[model samples]
Target: MAENQWSTAITSVKPNEIRVRGYRLDELMGRVSFGEAVYLILRGERPGAAVGRLVEAMLVASIDHGVTPPSTLAVRNAASTGASLNACIASGALAVNRHHGGAVEDCMRLLARGAARVAAGADLAAAARALIGEEKTAGRRLPGFGHRIHTDDPRSYRLLVLAREAGTAAAHVGVAEAIVAELAAGGKALPLNVDGAIAAVLADLGFDPELANGFFILARTAGWMAQVIEERRREKPMRRIDQGAAVYDGPASRELTQG
Candidate 1:
């Protein structure tokens, strides 16, 4: 927002138009599906139609899941207390932190490393094992391989199924399957959750990992905007929800006298 400031989500907020990374919207329209456009916007060029369409569809599929999503719940809470739509949306987005949307980026990093090892002629399973080992050694869970909610995340499985059905490659799809399989072989059922599958599919299509978060945020933005708009239409704000400030429980100290 300052002079010379820019973000790689690829936007020029001039001429009353937004060109995501220099490609005009008009040129992208109909020529690419929403997923391809998303890929192009983030990566600077469109991938093949099949891959692009698959990614776009994944984005669309995740837009919103009723009032259950935290963002939507935050918007609703804001509406209940009489807050502006934008304010409600900001509040909601504030709640989604490193723990939530961060997995895709982490997962992609692991895959990139594992893929490199595999490409260098290491066995695929061995590379995956090394990847998991490295993450554990770092005191973290292997990202993109599991979820907290589902015994095996059905949402992820369904999305991957659809992406594969839409002609996403077997190899990329196999990466996801292999991760799940490897996890299972360890006597764990850490299925490929949404983040892992998304990472594998996107990486297969050649998008940079830097674009991963932006692509995810774009999809999340739609859901956020929709909830914000809905809250706006409801004509009430969540004054109570935004009322309280933090209760400090840190160390208390007596005032020090200057010597």
Candidate 2:
């Protein structure tokens, strides 16, 4: 294949002309909110008011958790090392994976599966219960259920409320609620976290699961930039982090031995 043969339906560009999802880029600049633009670019259509709110809310929800989040730490650390803003932000984004700031994709997949099961006639409650049980039995924690800090994530609650008010709450939301109920029934009060809530809401809004993590990266980029800027302004260059606070339970330092 020739290089010019590589094509994209997302955008069309020529001299003095730019189009995205069939709209002139200049037309979209002031008329559409960033959230609406994001939806239009990714989903190929402008969102209804509710979807706009939902997308905006999703972006706002994960903007920052604090300095302790891996992404923030990465940004701060790189900034302390005198990295450029772009490099610091890139380092921050690179820290997002399954363990930190990455539950959205996993939660989206889970919610999608639950929604499908419900569409296939399984009761929401039953499906949720069974799925949660299977995950627990497999020693896997539900991606959007628990948080290390908040007992209840305020952002999750607000997003759900907005989704309901926007008339966008549907099967995936039901599945998420049912999962919460199932966890409650099992005496594990794992409330839905923001990642899970966003997954359900976005699923209801018809997003493909593959876009879930990308959405997170997009949203959190703002936070990374902010944190990087703050670190550069407030912290000394290459500040030494004390490792003494970490507990050492490993084997004692030993001399080399012949096998």
Candidate 3:
């Protein structure tokens, strides 16, 4: 390696071959799911089938949340102005700030704090309570505990169940649950939201907190594309993009057929 040359361990490109984390990209195409490939690329190792399934579930859970979300609105608004697909998608991605799609990383850090206290001989409930007190004293709101629309988030419940089934529900999951319990005991009664559930699962799965929000961005990209395409196909150019005014006129609820 020379001082003027940069290096990357993420991928290697040659004249006739491409490799990601030392595995040939072509070989990984059919042998692994997208979630498995993501894990392999990020962690530099393949995950078991169950873990891969859990990852895929997490992605599915966040694929869309309708037009009211800031990202979706941004996409639609940009598209209505006749923005290119890439630009519209960029608009959506830019909307994923600290309040919108960032709860995953924030909740991961909160869980880590509680987990560390538990590891240091504090009781789980006590640790959670202490964390709550600290955040209260700092006048900071607890992230990932509540939702504006959902009293009990279905995605949270499903993801937690899948995490347990995948054997990845460990310290962080326990801490998250303990926090929710403590919140209820304190009369707040905020249920764990999907972001919190993902945070716990990813923390237990040994992912870096900094990378947590990337999962949300990746999953929601599909939804952004859909919104952009719909805007381009159906809406008038330069129309006002009102988030709350939008109504669903799509297909009725239908069950998936069994294979």
Most TM-score-accurate candidate: 3
Check candidate 2 and list the clashing pairs: none
Score each candidate by Cα lDDT.
0.67, 0.86, 0.91
Q: List model 3 lDDT by residue over 1-259, tens digit each.
A: 7879987899999998999999999999999999998999999998999999999899999999999988888889899989999999889889887677888999999999989998999988998999899989999878878888898899999999999999989888998899899989878999888889999999999999999999998999999999988888899999987778888999888878732
On residues 78-150, what C-alpha lDDT tens digit does candidate 2 reach at each position? 8899999889988988998876778888888888888889999999998798789778899988988888888
- Count of steric clashes across candidates, in order: 9, 0, 0
Model 1 gets an lDDT of 0.67
Better by lDDT, candidate 2 or 1: 2
Deviation (Å) of 137 in candidate 1: 2.0
Q: List runs of model 2 lying over 4 Å from the truth.
A: 1-4, 240-259
* Model 1 per-residue lDDT tens digits across residues 74-98: 6567656667766776666665544
User: Per-candidate TM vs. native?
Assistant: 0.71, 0.89, 0.95
Worst 10 residues of 2 by lDDT: 241-250
Best by lDDT: 3
| Minimal lDDT window, size 10, model 3 | 250-259
Q: After superposition, how far is residue 243 of candidate 2 from its true place, in Å?
A: 12
